[model samples]
Target chain A: MLSLEYLQECYGFNHSKWKINGEILDTEKGVKRLTNWTEEKRVRWHVQWRDQLAEKTGCLTNRMIQTIHGERIILSDAGWVTLHDEVTSLFSYKNRENEIGAFFGRYFSLGMQDVDTEINDPYANNKLKIYLQQSFLTKNSTEEMRFLEGIRRESRLRYNKAKEIKEKAGGKQEPIVAPIRSLDQGKVVYGQFYWTNLKGRPEKGYGSLRNVLTEWLQRYGQTSLFSLLNEIDKEFSLKGYHGKNLLAECLTPWEFLEYVMKTRDVHEKDELLVWKEKLTYQWEASRLLVKALGEWLDVAQEKVTV
Target chain B: MTYEQPSSLAFSIKESVWLREGEEIDELLSLALEPDISIREADDQVFIRGSLLLFGEYKPKEQDSNSNSYSDQISFRSVEEVTMSDDGIGMIRHSFPLDVTIPREKINRLEDLYVTVDAFDYELPGKGCIELEANVSVSGIKHERTEEPEDTYDEQQDEESDDYYTRPQEYNDFSSEREEMNERSFHFEAVREAAADDETKDEYESRVEEIKGESKEFQNYERNAAFEQHYEEEDQYEQEENNEEPVSYNTDPEIEPEYEGETEPEPEPEPAPEPELVRSEPTVNFSPQPSPVSAVEETHELEEEGEEEAGRDQTEKSSSSKDENALYLTKMLTKGDQEEFSKLRMCIVQDGESLETIAERYNIQVSNLIRMNRLNEERVAEGQILYIPVKQTPTSKS
Candidate 1:
């Protein structure tokens, strides 16, 4: 995505045997990449994050190289361009769970929390009813109808539970600035996890925590979730409001909403099976996330009482 | 609030079974393993069930002269300690121990939950033995159940409800998350029209018959038309609310304006990861990123060394008639210039030496020693002889 001339002029990397391949530029210095983000704030946050992570935890992220103009991001015609010293080789961690947990622990303690707070209505799914109607029209078989009913019932229950939890927690929890790593956003490179090509907007909320934990369970399963939470607890105590907000966020039927929205493009009878499978998978991931969080909170409360 | 959360638990089972007997396994022909697994709950516990199908060629013994092949499809339960062999045809009893806890009270209404078994690392220790090691895992989700009346699609109730209309699509650059989560709605008037067409039954049948003759081409065109229509509709919706909301200034507005200038001074290069402009703390030193080498080249070098090992044993046995004066070098196969010996170097292990140090001393790769000597591991006993490879160059036949 970046030219050799740009790397030479902007970053002072002049190698005779340089070539561009995909998003990376192979130069003598290291692999330089073009990030997918153009937002100045998120880009700045990522640059600083890579620096701090490498400094504190001895983890080598793709550290941004400053241009001749002393800028991390250059405003080119193609948008914001950032050249990083990309670590290409894989680095194996001795204890993957504990080490990954330790890296995240240090990250949570980094004082870069955002102050902007605008709550999104998680229960607002006006399109779901339309999707439900469309599904009924298309898949009118008795068995399919029963399946739809079950899904609808589950969604209603999740919405009510999420509302109840939010009401109980009230506004006691202070939002923390955290990176939202969606399922496709998180990557494992250079022996550690990176929020690769981060597309999620910079935010300060408990939603990011819920999103990250959900992603971990989706990618790494339950053991990683437990170890991650436990290790993060050792550094940044996830005891009171943070814990409650995470629990409430978990109860939000984001999975059902996401899948119901997908029904707009699906028309094939066989595709409904795939649609059902994905919804079920998401539901399972969400349930396990909630269960793990519930168990963790129970243990935390016991420790507090003792 | 006391939330009705799904109970989470874990289980593990390990079982080793004799896959086959009698026939000695000659060569593993093919192994076909698919993770088409299902999870079931019984007696407040969850169990994983799957089948492993393997086909292999065997060396038939003297008594058995009919066939020299064995193909068996074995099915096993994750929880069963003792299981029947498939069809009672073979004597191989396979049962893999499984410890799995599925959160079933609320999320159990579903008929089947697919549990994926990770890729197995299989090994053959001896004849007629297949050892498979794999981790079985069930991962995340949440579902809720309640005793209210079951939800049915009531067309009358839907028509009466005020929430039938879709939201006007608004374009906002900052809130990409919200935009991604936004759903599109379509009216069901098309479905209603198709249903109420009472006078075109014969016309519809004739049209369907005509289309069936060129179904393949029609299907492609129909699929393309649907995609184009969907995209065009999305673009039209986006265009309707072209200027509904300006870019939000909620996120650090001051930072964007500051980056417009090119006057920021670069900090002195330090042995740390701290950027010059950002807030700095006491930095921890990290290892510099290693230079990227082509993984292909490394594997190529390993394969070349393997080829060299195959020819080393014959040369060692043949090179016995060496001159006493030529102390360090010996020539074994100098038939032509192409077959001349370069030189052979050997090292003896001492008390305080490792394979790595010996490699470093002789300026040869450790892999060359291991492959040449056929060493199983990196460790070497004291007073062991380690052969090192010398530089080889092509020579003309003299």
Candidate 2:
């Protein structure tokens, strides 16, 4: 029942300690701290994001997945996943290869855990995914793809430049730029949406994206990945009632795919399977693109082999 | 002796008339003839015409001796005829009657008797007057006339009557008595004036002499007392100045005690005891001879002792300086001798002596000690050592 304006005025929209797959993602810098904010402002921002998600979808629920190896798995209402296996998993899901597969395979095999069965209908996940895919295509899919592509291009450039710098310096220093994935696409899409809606004029879009990212990093990115992932789990449960419908509606297949990519990385062979699951209308649009891209890549590999 | 025939009474009657046309003369006569008759006319005419009867030697039956005896037989009448004018005054007049009678004894009692008649007379413009006739009677009884002595007695009585009319002799006596009283009063006043003059002179002389003597005596007494007081004051002033100099000098020893005897005796006795220290330390071997330099040093030392005593007194009197002196001595001893100073320090530390008490005993300033030791004066610790200055004695200058 809390309006977005009321939430924004009272709780604000800034995130605190964002995490992906149990690892903390670095925002840029100069982010305002949640502790520095009044409790009303903190709660308001939380409620705002919660409401936004709820407006798109039904009530969002959260589940904590604990692996047998003492790993933590946090699943969002849209089945976006985070794992706390290592600090590197917060930025890049490829680092948590074993833990990610264990969580996904367990969920697929067990169908629903006892904790998840207690809070939600056992059959709600399949319906929820379908709802998320429809909403993404209708409302957020194109924007999500655009945002993910921009972020991917930017991250690739940054990684290449960092790698080049390290090579030229002849140092063993790791690259400073984090790897990109489609899971970051959700945040990028929302960030760009916020930029356009909150900060952008018609004359200037994405004018303050860097500043926004910088502030997010400094304020909410200081905590460890495990704590951040736990906090995101709590945020999903707390925001379930408010932003469930909104998120259910706005989380399209592209957004879900982006969420999954940023949250979980796949090998090249499994990429098509991930695309097939996310894109609901295989005959309509994304299946063609996927097939064409797969054929072009096969041809290129064959050329390289020859 | 033939009594002269007493003359018969000759009586006459007079009538005076004024006819106013038929006035009867007989009526006038008839009226005149009445007994005890008297006729009067309007024109101032009077007539007496009454019978006089002779009664030779006959006394009347009812006659009393106290009454007068006289012949009563006489008659006179007179009538005057006058022409009355219109104013009723008579212009022309005629007398008509007269009567007379004589008794056997001549009546000689009448001397200057006169009868007067008054009548109304209009023409005369005033009341009328009477005409009088004089008569003299003589008796033939006296052959020789003699003066009686009784008459002379009467004449003398009459002359003595003038004396009654004048003032009596007692008036002169009263006047003289008044004059004498006045004289006595004058004499009394003069005597009182003289007595007052004598009293004033005597009082003025005695007062002048008394004042003069008292003034001289007062001047002498005042001069003697003033002289005595002047000498006493001078002596007292000099003694006070002398006393004050020593007290003030003792108060501030920067002004040295010039009186050697007063200051030296106490310190000399005390300093004599310190010689045992010199004797006991024979190895130190300080010279025993009291050289001139030693004397000078001793005097300086004595002066220092005096100054220190003064300072001690000041410190004792003043609460502020007690600590200062202790600190000063502690500093001095510490600066000069470290081991001995440390022993003193140990004493202070062990004895738990207060800074002020230590200051007084050591003859040093407490502040200086605190500064040297780098200790807070307010919080001096136990086991802190303080140095004490040795006080030296004074010697005789001679």
Whole-model lDDT, model 1: 0.40
lDDT of 2 by residue, B1-398 (tens): 11222111111111112222111121111111112323332222122233211111111111111211101101001111211222222232223112211121222222211122211111111112111111111122111112323112233443343343231221121211211111110000000101113432444335334322322100000000100000111111111100000100000001112222222211011111111110000000001111111111001101111333332332332343222221111110011100110011111222234666655544455663443333444444332323221211111000
Q: Write the per-residue lDDT of candidate 1 for residues B253-370, one digit (tens) a residue.
A: 0001111112211111222221111100100010011011100000000010111221122123224421111111001100111121122223334445688886675555677556
Please give, for residues A1-306, the per-residue lDDT of candidate 1 as tens digits: 556686678878777234455477777776667665556666676677667666876765556778888888877666777776554443332236677667666766665554333323333446644443333323334554545544554455455555555665677634434455553443467445654434344455466677777877766767677788888777666776666666767766666667666764777778878887787776766676777777777667777889
lDDT value, residue B191 of candidate 1: 7
Q: What range of 10 consecutive residues in model 2 chain B has the weakest lDDT sum?
A: B185-194
- lDDT against the true structure, per candidate, is 0.40, 0.22
Separate clash counts for every candidate = 19, 80
Interface RMSD of each: 21.2, 99.9
TM per candidate:
0.38, 0.11
